[model samples]
Target: MDLVGNLYLPEDFDANKKYKAIVGASPFPQVKEQVLGTYGPEMAKRGFVFLAFDYLGMGDSPALAGEFKQSRYMFRLIENTWDAVSYLGTLPYVEEIYGLGVCQGGSIIASAAVTDHRIKKLATVSGMMAADPFQWTDKDVAHQMIAAANISAQKIYETGEPDYVAPFGLNDDQSKEEFVSAAAYPAMAGESYDYYGRDGFRGPKAVENFSNMHIGDQAMQSLFSLCEHYADKIVQPTLVVYGQDAPTAICSTAFIDRLTNDPEVSAFGGFSHVDFYYKPEAVEKSADTVAAFFNK
Candidate 1:
């Protein structure tokens, strides 16, 4: 869909010679900058062209109404990503595209790589390959999320209208002061606002055609169901980096165990899910791991 992208070319890049390239996928609610910006340039410094793009309906890309079946939604996401990878292929100097995904982006690239041979290698940082409601300390919330999405999906099926709900946003009746106190993951929610809310870390991108705050129920359902059916299909060499302290660390465990290909897993000390994408030490370590893996 003519997605917007920033291609970080290696220093002294030659147009005639084929070079390995990496496609960087953004974490949920983030534009290319939130996570990809943190590592894309660094990877380029390590001598590879890095391409980071906004998905369709995100950043500066064309917008689609946010309502569809889970599989269809995921299919669109996969196609849009391959669109970026395909663009890389069009470049005369590009060869052997690799994928680097952060958080949910990690899940996405993993799904995409299942059949897309173009992705010769893959790496994910704190990627959520699967969700188990029982894993959360507050299992009720986990079940609530699934129930809520299914309820919304039922509404869509009956009414033929999208249920516009901010999965994490406080309801209109809820007080902003209660954001931190009542939030499921108070710290993550607060940081999310800081990074993407008005005048926040990535507010500029948030303001520009980036409407990830509200997701359709079907989309949420699809996201929840991701990797349950296809994770093992990833045969390409893969690397998964997780934060030892991250809440979502368990999500990657299943992928590592189930991935038929021997997936390399690394855990960085003193890092949380957010830290893996934002903290300098974690980002550097993961990026180095990714560069080394790709170069191999």
Candidate 2:
């Protein structure tokens, strides 16, 4: 689909020189301008080229033919990663290519890397690699999520218009002030909301095409994107990083345990899963750690 992307080059980018490159897979429903935006420059500053793109149906990339933007079907996202790796190979200056995934992006890259050895190494920051949370953890919630996805899909078929909802069980109508003042961030009581509703840090005011809603059918797609089921098959050197106190840390910890390789882990204190997205300290430390791992 000729996916849209933003490639961040090192300050002294030289066409004649071969440099290691990193292809970043972003969290679910996020464009290249969000988490990738925060880390791309940092990776570039560290002497690497970073490629961040919108998955086929998300962000600025063209949606699947006849499908809606933000459809974000899981299988297509993996194919998009493979296509991104192909794009990196086209650059004569790119030496080694690596994969970096944030949140669900981690799962996406790993699922892609299973057969695409073109990606030499792998790294995941606050990755939600395990599927149990969304698939088997609670049968009732899983059934409920599946039901909602079915209804959303049928609505589109019946009305020929996309249905958007706050996937994280957020009130799509709430004001930004209301979200900022919120005492607790109930991390997706349902499945997802658009790219913004989770944290006040990056909301509608922060970027274009920003919204608290996404296609309601995404809940069904996430079930097929998990990586832990095949983590043992991955032989590439891997580095896993996450906020120690983050509720979702289990996603990373459990994933690393399933890896066949003796993967490295960097558990930083005082940062949550979302902190690595843009918080100064979290980004600084996490990026440095990821850069070091890729450099090694």
Worst 10 residues of 2 by lDDT: 186-195
In order, candidate lDDTs are 0.73, 0.83
Model 1, span 68-87: residue lDDT tens: 31122555667888888889
96-198: candidate 2 lDDT, tens digit per residue: 9999999999999999998899999999999988757635678888889899999998999899888987776455456545544553554432112223654
For model 2, state the Cα shift of residue 261 in Å: 0.9
* Model 1 error, position 194 (Å): 4.1
TM-score of 1: 0.83
